[model samples]
Target: MMRSIDYGNLMHRAMRGLIIEVLRQVEEGGLPGEHHFFITFDTRHPDAALADWLKQRYPEEMTVVMQHWFDNLHVDDEGFAVTLNFGDQPEPLYIPFDAIRTFVDPSVEFGLRFEAPADDDEDEEEDDDGGDDDPAPSSDRQDAEIVRLDRWRK
Candidate 1:
């Protein structure tokens, strides 16, 4: 068979691109209508930048709301930077797109949760797959841990 397209990775890129585009629009003219965003990202990402206090507070993943008040909203190819009020004290943050786990707009009830990239251990296991069979799908049990976007939508 010809080289199979890595749709999973492709989808991840597309989703991140969608976020970049949306943010760029907001950066230019502000959020339209009732739109806002809740972005969750890995604070541990190598390139993630935030106040050390914030990192100490949220050692793992952190979620930020982009509604109401935010300042200096700037977005580029890699990610975005914004200043948010944290307990009445403004703090600056720079989150890389690849570090984002979820991006949601509650007003529209739209949400997306990214899958964690596969590990080398899983790859080694797949090498023993029996011949004459299609390659198994790349996924993990954690992939099933989805964030329900909305109950009323369905």
Candidate 2:
């Protein structure tokens, strides 16, 4: 017998498209009209490359601020890359199109979550605030770390 399609995965896939589009908007126009994005993804994912020092320090989740402080923003068919200063250190990151897991904009209460590709056998670390509602620091950084999540959508 024929099997039914999984709508859950289908929806997740659709959200993936929307997430990329939103990101492209920022990539193109530089976060127009008070629209900033909170994007979280796997730091150790194959296509992502952080300075060895940052990987040692964070080991897992990193969240980036796409407002006020980001540079070298470029996007292509493969994915996007950008430069942001973390603390006093500058880092470059390459993110694949399929690696983005969550996108949120607190300014408008808009959000999207998806099943991004996973890293292999890496122990996930919780955010420093113990999963509480602590605001991420806003600095004059040109780049921010991509935020990491404590839990998976699956």
Candidate 3:
């Protein structure tokens, strides 16, 4: 029997906190060694912000890479914002924690997938992840071992 303690939610909080910590570190000292990230998030999330073109291009979801050239990476308790170059145009975006679908670091072959509850209740503030099941794979993840959190989510 599942306990009422809601360990799942706790774990989710921990995982999201982990991302915040990492980003904080990066914000302070910059990314270490070959450690870059592939963050896939829901474009339609209420708090997510992006350019009109980007939103239209990725109406459902979008993935961004943090590598050689990225700037203004600000991370707080709720989410993060960054400026990334797209075809020579620097685009800024804000991604909330719940909006993330997947977070992957191909260089270390580390990954995390966040999913909403099995029941589809879009109105619940604490019971949903902004995105769907469709994966947003990074080009570099082709050779890495991806970890999934699907079973635990169920």
Candidate 4:
């Protein structure tokens, strides 16, 4: 049996750390010219905190644009908090790092995709890959479903 280290998980953590660093910089001096973030996260994640109205609007997932007009931006080891305008009402949001699915900085054409933590039941299913009746999605199949950030750039 071959022992395989989970580099993918490690890379995910590193990328998440990068996201935190960028947010920290922005919190200190504000977003630089043409620099903004499109942060996509799973709304159903337990650590995700949002207004009831916003949750009703985005039941499954939500992408928040961190640009002008946001306030009280704070990032910590576990998660981040920011105030965004929803229908002209300032709404507070708290999202944990583990819930983030994608992070994109279109100005620089940079993006990172993360595999969200699987629920306990899903994790059990994933571990039972030995069953011949159920096959897991191939890596290529999963990649095909993800929208490439480069495609959005000129």
Best by TM-score: 1
Better of 1 and 4 by lDDT: 1
User: What overall lDDT goes with each candidate model?
Assistant: 0.72, 0.60, 0.73, 0.70
TM-score of each: 0.77, 0.69, 0.76, 0.76
Q: Identify the runs in model 4 with alpha carbons over 4 angstroms from their true place.
A: 116-147, 150-154
Query: Any residue pairs clashing in model 1, and if so which?
Result: none
Q: Which runs of model 3 end up more than 4 angstroms from their true locations?
A: 1-3, 119-154
The best candidate in terms of lDDT: 3
Overall local distance difference test of candidate 3: 0.73
- The window of 10 residues in a row where model 3 has the poorest summed lDDT is 137-146
Candidate 4 lDDT score at position 89: 92
Instruction: Summing lDDT over every window of 10 consecutive residues in candidate 1, give the lowest-scoring window.
Output: 125-134
Cα lDDT of model 3 by residue, 100-140, tens digit = 76788877667876655542443432213334444443321
Model 1 TM-score on a 0 to 1 scale: 0.77
lDDT of 3 at 7: 60
Clashes of each: 0, 8, 0, 0
